[model samples]
Structures are given as structure tokens and as C-alpha cells.
Target: MRTNSPETKKTARELRNDPVLSKEYTKNKIQFQNYYFKLGYQWSKPDLNSIVCRFAVLIQVIRIKREELTESFIEYDTRFLGGNFQIPDSKELLLLIFLNAPLYQVFTTLRKCSKRKEKYYKDRVGQRFEIQIGYE
Candidate 1:
């Protein structure tokens, strides 16, 4: 797993120093809310990662254990989006986490994951993956 713990370490320092990052974060939050208001697929929202992290924190505040967060996500997904995903659905969760996680934490986690992937195989950076549908 990528290490996002570094982000947690810098949270106080970043909050104290950078007004720009803070403004960007606040702007993203509003964009996320507007996306939800439009009734777009929840996946289309921009600040999904932050939302996920927020939910994790919320669960803790509600006296739920961190160990139960995955199960809670499953429950929340089923209730809001119809059913639990067959595979781990981190795309949406990542978006929420990114938004909710401290900026430094998000970047660190992404960097670690990228490095780990590179260690296993040569990656084609900028390669595009697409899907095409044929209708009869």
C-alpha cells in the first residue's frame, strides 16, 4: 500500500503556511457540492477522495471503529448507489479520500503507489485506455 502517513505529518505546517492550497481546497469543496446538486453520477464529482476521508473521520466520531470502515463503505454504497461493488471500488473512494485527506497525505500515497508499481513492471506513462461500444 502507498504511504499517505507523511501527509498527516505535514497537516499542521501546511495549514499554517499556505493560503493558496487552502483556497484551492475550499474551491474544490464547492465544486464537489455543485456536482452533487446536478445529480450527476456520484463518481463524476471532483472531490471524492476528500469526501471518503471525511466519512472515515465521521465514522470514528460516531464511535465506529476504524476496522469497520470498509464494511461501512459497503453499507453506504449499497444504500446510496444500489449495490456493493463486485471488486474493490477505490476510484470513487480515492476521490473522496483525496479531497478529505490532507493534501500532503494524498500526494505521498500516490507517489508511493506509483513507485511500487514501477518496481514490478515498466509502465507506459501517458498511455491511454479506452472503451468502445458497438451497437447492432
Candidate 2:
């Protein structure tokens, strides 16, 4: 649980607005303000509903209950979702797996979305436009 303060947010704003860092951050699409709050020790509990709302915009991501998370939770979730287990000898590695689980899904979903083709048709006469008509 990270804590955020107004002073910290102001500092982050300055850093994010810096020319060099701002370019790099924009190129990487890194939200410095968000990361600042996440790393801040005084930040409040994350809003799970916000995650869901973002997902509703075709983000294809979701946050599980914090109670449902554990070090080995990622491995367990992978097995549950894929019906298999990964053989890892290190317990530490197993614990770290959960933290990155969302990453795998997020990348995969983004790739899939990118590869999809948008369908279009000619409505009347040689005019290309999208249509929303009866499926019958």
C-alpha cells in the first residue's frame, strides 16, 4: 500500500514536465504521476473499480481482490487458467510470478487487437462507409 502526498505529486509533476524526461516518458508511455503514487508509501488503497472501467474500454485487463493475491498466486492462476503448471525450482521466482501475470495477458491482448482488421463496405454507390444494420 503506497501513500501519496500533495508535495510528492507536485515534485512528480515537475519531473514529468522536464523536457528530457518528458520526451522519454511520452515515448515510453509511462505515466510518471501514476507511478509516483504507486511507489509512495502513504498512498491509499487502489481503486479496483477504476481498473475495471479502464478494462471496459477494451483494455482486456482486470484486477483481482488483494486478498486473492500471494507470491505464488501467479503460478496458481496460470495453472488454473491454462490447466497446467510451470516447473520452477525457486520459491522466490514462484512468488514473483503473480506480479507479472497481468503483463502477459495485456501484451497478448494488445497484439491481438492490433492484428484485427476493421471491416467496411460500400453502402449506396461506390462510397465506403461502416454500416450497422440487421444481421438477418
Candidate 3:
């Protein structure tokens, strides 16, 4: 896990202020704070339910090395409320392959390079990728 630096603080602030968040704080505040504490965050007074804090915690959880994620655990698609919709694990495998594939890398690189005004693509991309993947 990465250390909590200025970048982390900035990210936390951004998450706290994100307008699209549901505005609901987590019920398990202490446990949430403790989780981040274990991951090296030093929050003076953390809001567990805050979107940013929750997002940070989620990032640490899912960013575990790819090898650590087990394929044996069955995942269900509960889209149609109460409907028994099960998706094949292959869907997840395909997504993982695409994300790690060279073609996706090339597409992302080209997209970043084409943005003439933005010189901080690496930082932006890192944060964007984290948020996008975390949400998905």
C-alpha cells in the first residue's frame, strides 16, 4: 500500500467534495477509520461515511494484486432487483484481460498524449483510473 502523502490528502479532499456522492455516511465509522489507519492514513478526524474516505478504503481493498483475487468465488448480477441473473466468471476474466492488454494501453496513451493543454497526464490518469475501476 502507498503512504499517505500530499497527494492522498488532495484526493481525500476531492472525494469529500464530490457532488455526485449519495451524501450518506457509513454506519461503521470506527471500523472504517481503523481500516484506513492500517493502510497508513493519518486522519485527525475522519468522516467514515464521506465519499472520499470510503473511496480511499475501497481502493486499497480492490487494488490487491491480481493474483490475490480468486476466480472461484461466484459473482451474481443482481440487476433486476430480486431476479436470479448470474453472469459467467469469464466476463470478469475478459475485462481483466482487456484492461491489462497492450491495445488498451496504447489507446489510453494516445488519449492522454492528445490532450495538449494537460501536462500532468500521469497524475490525472492514475487518479482517474483508480476512481473508474473502483466504481466499476
Candidate 4:
């Protein structure tokens, strides 16, 4: 008989609780807080739970989809993003895909992220992260 392997991350909540995730998000505490900023709640308030949770889920989904598409893990670069622009999740993975993947994979990798609307993020983040890397 055969069995499937377990998921590395079942949900965003699990990732959020991870010490590594905590360390990365905490780099710019204020920015993370602002991601869920509520008029009255602000940071350190229980009222912000759902809002923060939503972003957490989004983060988890994006990371997962990107990984699945790339067929490899990705991570934020320790060095500053080479371009003048900065996004919350560094474009390190995108660069790796563009530079290394086959043309078809590269096109798919680039297109997958923007296939949806209402998820465009244009900003800088200092969070640090590293995901496993291997080419299939």
C-alpha cells in the first residue's frame, strides 16, 4: 500500500505561530500591524484578530501557489532588493525562476501571480525568510 506525505504547512495559522515566521514578521512590527490596521484597534488589540488573520492567509496562499508553480521553494534575499522598488515578499523567487527555469516555466511563473486582481502589493518590507530550493 502507498500513502501520501503530510503537508509542510496545513494552514496559515500554523505558519503564523512558527518562530521563524514570527521573527520575519516582527522585523517591521509596525508594518505588519498596519497590514491589518483598524481605525480603533491599532496594534496590540484583540479587535484586529480577523484582519490580521486574513492577511496571514493571503500570505500563506501566495507562498504556496508560487512554490507549487515553481516546483521549488523560494525565499526573501538578505541583501536589499536590487531594484529601487521593494515589495513585502522580496522578488527573489521570481528572479530565480526567470534566470533558471525553462521559458515555459518562466512565463507560467510570471503569469500566475498576477492572474488575480485585488492582490497587488506595492511596497517595501524588511522581513527575512528562506525556503528550500531544488529544481525538479
lDDT of each: 0.29, 0.27, 0.28, 0.27
Model 2's TM-score against the true structure: 0.19
Per-candidate TM vs. native? 0.20, 0.19, 0.18, 0.16
- Per-residue lDDT over 1-136 for candidate 2, one digit per residue giving the tens place of the 0 to 100 score: 2248888888889988897665433221111112111111122544433321111012222323334445454433333222433333332221110111223322111111111111111111122112111231
Task: State each candidate's clash count.
Answer: 12, 7, 2, 0
Candidate 2 lDDT (Cα, 0 to 1):
0.27
lDDT of 4 by residue, 1-136 (tens): 2244345445555778887665455322112212212212234545533322211111212223333432222122221123121223523232211111112211111222342321332121222222211220
Q: Put the candidates in TM-score order, highest first.
A: 1, 2, 3, 4
Candidate 1, run of 10 with poorest lDDT: 54-63
Reference-based lDDT, residue 92, model 2: 23
Model 1 scores a TM of 0.20
What is the Å distance of residue 2 in model 2 from its true position?
8.5
Off by over 4 Å in 2: 1-3, 26-136
Instruction: In model 2, state the lDDT of residue 76.
Output: 36
Q: Clashes in model 2: which pairs?
A: 2-43, 3-41, 3-42, 3-43, 4-42, 4-43, 71-95
Give a tens-digit lDDT track for model 3, residues 88-122: 33322211101212223211111111223133332
What is candidate 1's lDDT per residue for 19-134, written digit by digit as tens? 66554332111112121211223564555333333211111101123334565454443332333424232332221222122332221011112334443222322221111112
